[model samples]
Target: MSYLRFDKTLLTNLEESLTREVLRTNRSGAYHCSTIVDCNTRKYHGLLVIPVPELDDENHVLLSSLDETVIQHGAEFNLGLHKYHGDNFSPRGHKYIREFECEKVPTTLYRVGGVVLKKEKVFVHHENRILIRYTLVDAHSETILRLRPYLAFRSVRQYTHENAQASRHYDEVENGIKTCMYPGYPELYMQFSKENTFHFQPDWYRGIEYPKEQERGYDFNEDLYVPGYFEFNIKKGESVTFAGGISAIDTASLNDLFTYEVEKRIPRDSFKNCLINTAHQFLNKQGEESYILAGYPWFKCRARDMFISLPGLTLAIGEVEKFEVVMQTAVKAVYAFMNGETTDLKVYEMEHPDVLMWAVWTVQQYAKMVSREAAKEKYGQLLKDIMTYLADGKHPNLQVHDNGLVYANGREKAITWMNSTVNGRPVVARTGYIVEFNSLWYNALRFVADLFVEDGEFSFRLNQIADKTAVSFIDTFLNEYGYLLDFVDGNMMDWSVRPNMIFAAAFDYSPLDAKQKKGVVDIVTKELLTPKGIRSLSPKSGGYNPNYVGPQIQRDYAYHQGTAWPWLEGFYLEAYLRIYKRSAISFVERQMISYEDQMTCHCVGSIPELFDGNPPFQGRGAVSFAMNVAEILRTLNLLAKYDNQ
Candidate 1:
């Protein structure tokens, strides 16, 4: 569990939701620097900002509200700022960003009536069952301008360890504290409070105001990862929900919000070990299942995300209870998807074809993983029905194409993730023959095949599903040159070398031998490899573009052409693990070119959402995605165990 910031109503990354981020991506000209640092306070894993507001300097104010920001963190940022950057620059003399190792936990805020409450979770050690739930009350506000707040907190840990020092100096400092030049105009800032609250500071006090410039003792709003509390402001009689990443001092939670931190120490599963312990840190923290597919950066809820991320986020890592909760939430979506309640079905979501496929896969996978027999029976049977619906092509007015892929709002695009678009045309969603879709299909077929494998149990139906897949993979997908086509019936540029081919056999479905697998790997490795991770396509493709740092529209148009997605890094790693089951070490060497190169040289540990499509690749887009990080870590764990002599 890297780090998550959530409230009862909304959940998002704690570091991400800070109001200061608005400055980083600001259309105005405000710079932001945020980091997860030790209480001792020096910047480590420093995520600097080369703020590029979406607006072209119509207004220039960082502290005011505008959403334009340019986030450059870790190695990706280092390269972009140092080598490839244009006007975007980090401070002139500060050392470049590097990934620092610090075990942080999920942070949360909740609104309970007028009192907005908060919870901070910390896992000092993964194997340990100890989970510290630090609860506090967020300050409220009448107006952000005039507000003062107070808070109190106590740490109740039986086990103790010293926190690394992170006092920050604009340059460097011993306690991690550096007096700001005392005079400079930067968008974000930090400082220490002069007053006392209940004899000591609160366990956690966020929601500080970001000044238009740095004030000596102040740094970034998210700099401190400590368990102590700080105070801001609260409106006297105004209502508060008890959760907020930042506050203008609307309402205050007095003694009610303050309490000794409680360690809801649950027993760790002695049964299995891997990244499970870390996964549990995020997944097991109260109500994690309900929030799945809910938002991006952890936003944007979808049926596909809940199930696709179920094992890694909820099940394999967290408690069994979360599995049930997520399964419950997802099963409804599965049925809805099978019945054609796509993202477009709701007024909020425009429809798409991927939901059905993702739901079908999730329902079955959930059924398979659930330890309960009754749930297995019910969901398994439901899976069969869903699979049958997919087999027969069951949308009412919608016709399934010859190759079993669902089309967008009647003849439009939109099948898989990468469902973003520009000027009404789908961006990177290679509809007809997406690699992962067929990979997922192959998995479903094999899942059924395994279920009835005893005496060729599912042999008839299994063989049929397998045969259909084989036909589709060979006849529909395989282009004359033998390379799998990227899409079935799109524009003329369907043969662009992309990561889609890896999915054909990554699961149990493909009839892929070493030769076919070798071809797919070769195409992707040569064309897709960038310093950050896997590029979306061959740089040589006509539609390809590598510069992902810019306005959303431009980014979307060039989105998949050459953007290096860390998510694809997982699939590529998975394919390597599957194909070279024996040559694990060698495959790992090839699979992790970016991580090895970038993590140490660029963004050390934290994986950025994407890299610029071109050379001197810089991380761009959302700072991180759970699936991406979890999968990369999973890949590393795979290498660790398999490579063990």
Candidate 2:
């Protein structure tokens, strides 16, 4: 059996199968996502979702789904699933699924009476294209295959309805058809490897309900335009490839193209390989610039997420070139931001107060991975400029106070990563001397000081500033309980037991002493640690929510209150090992069991953004998060280092 195989028992059950989503992406910000049974449970799910730079920043779903039918002895089997009104299902195609596995690429086996067929999907790298190959494994007689294309030419965040403005016209390209649903959008070119017939009959499928959307309290109903179906014959043991893309391709090369793309995939053969595969999926390379997408389905290239995730996503996986390219673009954007100029790169939220701090940490990882000499040769000036920028109090929100710690004013906006808002206001208004920011600030200062140790005057100045910051950090955040406070503003100190204080113990240059770091770790392990990750808040805290459910507003409220974030576990484990040394290796290894088991749940072969803080700890939020995946990989790398030692 394959590593990620599911039998008919699981494949036939809609409750289990629909929750297991699969994602395939092209490195250029296009992806194909749906459930294992080829059902789109969310509006963001589609067969071909790509970015149209001219249209807007958000991704658009060009081809919503493709319904497949098998004909044998004049009997037709509709092997496609869709949720309709009143809790109804049309086609009910999941019943025919015999097995679903994703060893190399997502492959599904179907048994429809006397015929057995296999389907495999691959999203081509660096291109806006998806190739699906259908092979007839066994058949008693000749089989006919019919494929119907569903089009939803709108942004992924919005739904479309039956409108007269939609173009019903299509043009024939060699062995295929090209259609453009609206103006200012790229024409969708769908082609087949073998000769096939194109039947253009434009009609709308109305009242298609997305249950996931309804659960999130959004509009669930949508109208999809079906432009008829393509009919073709297939002999036993024969395979045919279908390609959906924005541009026309040579029809005869479809089979070779599909095989080539499949060959490029890193097989999902083990837990580590699964994570390595998912790590590559977050990379979005455009022309000379490359970026790390925050998450799949709906996220963009946010600056904080890119910097936080860049090293683990690239360096840990041994993709050093990718690390360099992504950082090159990001460094340019950072320099542009400091100079008060607009950047051509697509990275968002460059003005966030802590992004520069994380960027320094990302470079610190590079120094550890390769060498300090190499890092200084490449990013030395960037580090100096960042420290200089922060020290001079040039940032709009971040200021260097006389106490030598950076203070941020998040009262009016959500400046930090816990940035979920209710009504354009921060949910947790963490203002004035956040713990992690100062932890990173002290670390960055000391790291740059050591890198430039030959410069006597510069290093001396940085060490003086860092010494004051260290003293101020402990005086401001450390409490009588032995653990650090979340933040301090004036006389008010937020005593919420949050995972943000973990950084104080995790970073290399921390203000906390050995006993103090151990105290913080023990408190977190007692109240906030879960089998899955570290909870955002302790249950003992008031207004603590352990579940991430209900409507959008309710989910946002619970997002950071008590939700367990897997990314935080990386730092927690790092701090654990730092305190306990080799004795903590077994405990750290045990914590990884839950994440390994999660490889087969939820998004399958990937980790989600967060999970419920309570028992069972069901995964929530984005299906494939960059930070979550990167951190897990980073932990694995850390563990391997200890094992070698």
Candidate 3:
């Protein structure tokens, strides 16, 4: 039996089918997303969404969806699903869905009366393109397939309407048409594999409601433009493909191009293979450099996420060349920031100061895979430049204190990953010397100091600073509550039992002693550990909010309060293995293996962003989050490394 195939019993259930979503992405920053049954329920759900550099840097929805119809013996069967105003599902095409499977790609089979049809979708890598192939499986008579394209031509954040200002013209290309409805946007070229006629008719598809957007308390209704339709005569055992992209495509070799792309994909036959395939999709190349995209559906290349995910997403899989490219790209961003030059290094603007420290620690991880001498030869200057800028207190509201610990404050909201604001105020306003920040600071100082050991004076100065920071770390963050204090400003200490405390044991050079390390792990395991990950806040803590639901404000308030972030599992497992040593081999394997079942359950092999803190921890964030998947892959690598005694 296929591991990821869904029969009609599940696909026909509209409520169950709509809850599961599928995503396909290309290296050119384009993606196709929709429900398992080809029904769109979110504003972010689109067949072709890409970054329009001329208009803005964010993604714009060009082609929202394609409605397909099959006709046999003068009888028509609608195989498309849509939602309109007043919670109505028009055409109700999901009832014809016989099966849905996601192995190498997402494929759906539709059985209308006696005619069997199969549809396969794949996003072309390194290009802004989507290919959809339709094959007639078991048709007794000749059949015709009709495809209607629904164009949004607006930013994903906004809805379009039936306005007169919109353009309604098309230019003929290859075997199809090209159109750009708005100014300052790239035109899209759409083509079919066979000879076809495009009827010159235009109409408005109005009152289309997105249920996911409505739940988020945003305007969910929009109007789409349908530019006629394409009709093709399909026969049994014959296949036809539709190509959509920003530039004109060669229709003659379209099938060959699709075949080449499909052949390049890695196998996804097992749980581990599925993860490997998903991990390969996160890296996108532009010109001579490559960067890691934070997540799919709706995310950009963020600096903090890139650093955090680089080691696992690249190095752990023996992708040393790509790893170096990503590191070089990030370091260049820091260099540009220090020199006050215009840069494309768009990280989280209100980022925690620890992100820079994580970049340094990532270098240390890379050194283990390669050699320190080799790393120094390639990245020595960039690393030194970053440290010099940090020591000089160049960044906003961030400074190295006289006591040697880094102090990052004065921001209206928190700067770290927990920096979620509700109604213009940070929900968890932690402003001070955060525990994780100081731990990373101490490790970075020591690691960089070791790199300059041949230079005596520089090495001594760096080690001296790290030594002082170690003393301050114990005095300020270690507490009588059996765990580390979350953060401190002046004499005020925030003793919230959060997962941030685990980093002290997980870092390359933790200041905590053996007794202290065991104490930290014990407290975290008892209070914050769950099957999915560690909760952001302990249940006993006053600020703990178990559910992450509701509108923007409510979700923000609960984002870091008690939501369980699966990305933290990497650090938690690393710390546990550090304190427990080789005795943790069996335990680690069992715990990590338990998540294999989850691969088939949610998002089809990729992990999600977060889960509820309560029991039965239902996933509650983005469907296929890159950070969570990277951490899981890193944990598996760690287990293999430590279990081989």
Candidate 4:
């Protein structure tokens, strides 16, 4: 009863296996992603996808996939699968799979004609590298293994075509060869632990159709270059290690390096441990500081996501130093933004209003995890400067009203997390007095007041501001139906039922009264609650789109309208526990079981970004989402605190 193992029956079932994906990442912002059966159904699917500094800032696909074939007495059996044009599968290697396990790392077993081989893959953290070990678990005699490397030297957003611009060449290094198809792109070094065979036959693999890309309404066909094959001979119980990296690896040290990397991993025996391990992958360090990646395969380090995810991904794991480092990095980035020192908009830019509020909330969480003195010692002046800047309306499209509520207004309505826009217009125009932003704003103000008790004048100012905001929060947002209005501006109240109101009751320093808290919880539980998570919008709301499907524009509209985000479960659970007290522990425990079960589906040991709001909420969006994983870990940490109490 291995919790994360899939037998041959499931592996051979193309429909089932292809939908499920496995992800491995290195903190260097590189990843390995493919279907459970080693088949790539999407252009983003690759054995090595890393950020190329010299190229565009986006990720690029270097090694699309590696096809391994077993040669037994001249009969060759390909243990790799690929889908070509016309919906046809070539080599059908999935049929030979014995089992797929993902407890420690992703391991696949293959049994072919009395020869049993097990393949294990691990992405080295802090480096752009992948180590794959192939062991002949059982065999009657020596067997030869041939590996063909498929190279797609293109951005992850674009499809590659057969062109003469690609240099079909290689340079020998250590125990293997290094090559770069495109000049200025990082050179790809591939090597085996033992030198056996290398043949340089360059060819093109054309008409490779990625169905997932087509489903997303994009060009689905690609052409990858195959740079010959490498042959290896192995006897029973002998293992050979293969290394693929952007830079030339120490070929003589591959065996030791692989062992060291695998041994350094903490055991993941439980779902909690699995999530903690996955959470660690979301952290990448540059220079001497650490940053949190929003999600895998696509998303980069986002201010909003990193702040929202900080508590769970770092402090919840008892990583106080790393949490401090992240906060320091964020503060430095903010200062850089203020000083106009950075043109790197993606990292330094702060557009979302709620993201700024979450930054203060993250400091409050860190204060709880460490100490007020420690937090203030590191971030006190920085926090004060940010508060002053925000209060003076230095941030774009945002200002504090004389009534004390934060107001953000812009023609571009994509200012908050519900920032899904179609064409040039926002799909959900929640421009003024957004629910979540105000709740967090109130919370942030209150937190600063409490944290800086010594600064009486500043604390008094924040308290007065918070008190004014509280009155407006209730008067403007609370509707007659007992549910909070989603947002309000000049008698135009967007009275949509959304999970954003939950934060009012979920936070420690909530402005909502007991009756208001209960009303908010009841409304959300009744409409937005699902086994997976809380939906962004209620189904009964006008313009509610229950499914997160279709092409880019369609998907964008559904993204925040009704798509269920699993990460919001943490806030919902917090509000539920706050409203119910100790009695809610059992309920929380029961609800958490579903998430643990979720680990067995979709991306094994990881979480997906969005799910359908309708019943039977299938996982949608990114295969491995960092925010979802962080939220799950955060909930488990909170659960532990409640259970202990």
Best by TM-score: 2
The worst-scoring run of ten residues by lDDT in candidate 4 lies at 340-349
Question: Which digits, one per residue and each the tens of the lDDT, describe model 2 over residues 434-525?
Answer: 99999999999899999999989888988999999989998999999988999899998999999999998999888889999999999999
Clash-forming residue pairs, model 2:
none
Q: Rate the local accuracy (lDDT) of all candidates.
A: 0.42, 0.93, 0.83, 0.86
TM-score per candidate, in order? Answer: 0.57, 0.99, 0.97, 0.98
Better of 1 and 4 by lDDT: 4
Off by over 4 Å in 4: 343-349
Model 3, residue 265: distance off in Å is: 0.8
Score candidate 3 by lDDT. Answer: 0.83
Runs with alpha carbons beyond 4 Å of true place in candidate 2: none
lDDT of 3 by residue, 1-645 (tens): 666788999999987888788877886577888989887888888999888877887888999988889999899898889999888997898999999988878889999988999998888997888998888998988899989999989887788999997889999887789998889888988898888778878999999999988877778899999988888888899888899889888798887887887888776788767777878778867666677888876777777788888888877777888888777778777666667688665544424566777788788888887789887888887778777778778866678999998888734766787878876777877778888888888888888988988878777878898899999899889988779999899887788899998999888798889899889999989999888889999999997997888888888888998989888988888888988889887777776776776666556767777888887887777777777878888888888788676
lDDT of 4 by residue, 411-511 (tens): 46677777788888888888788888889989988888888878999989899999999998888888899988888878888888999899999998878
Q: Report the lDDT tens digits of candidate 1 across residue range 1-645.
A: 222222312112223222112101111111222332111111111122222123221112221111101111211111111111232222211121122221232233333223333323322221211121222343333222111111111011111122333222232121111122112223122122212121122222233222211211334232122222223233433322221111121123321221211233222222122134323322321122343532112233445544555555554343457766656655655566566555322111213445555555554544444543544465666656655665565744233455544333423565566666877877764654555656666666666555545536443665566666666666666666556777665553367877777766455456566778767776777788665678887877778887774556777766677888766766676676776776756756565554543332122223455778787786665443445555565466556667774
- Highest lDDT: which candidate? 2
How many clashes does each candidate structure show, in the order listed?
A: 70, 0, 1, 0
Lowest lDDT 10-mer window, candidate 1?
151-160
Question: Per TM-score, what order, best first?
Answer: 2, 4, 3, 1
> How far off is residue 345 in model 2, in Å?
1.4
Position 324, candidate 3: lDDT: 85
How far is 434's C-alpha from truth in model 2 (Å)?
0.8
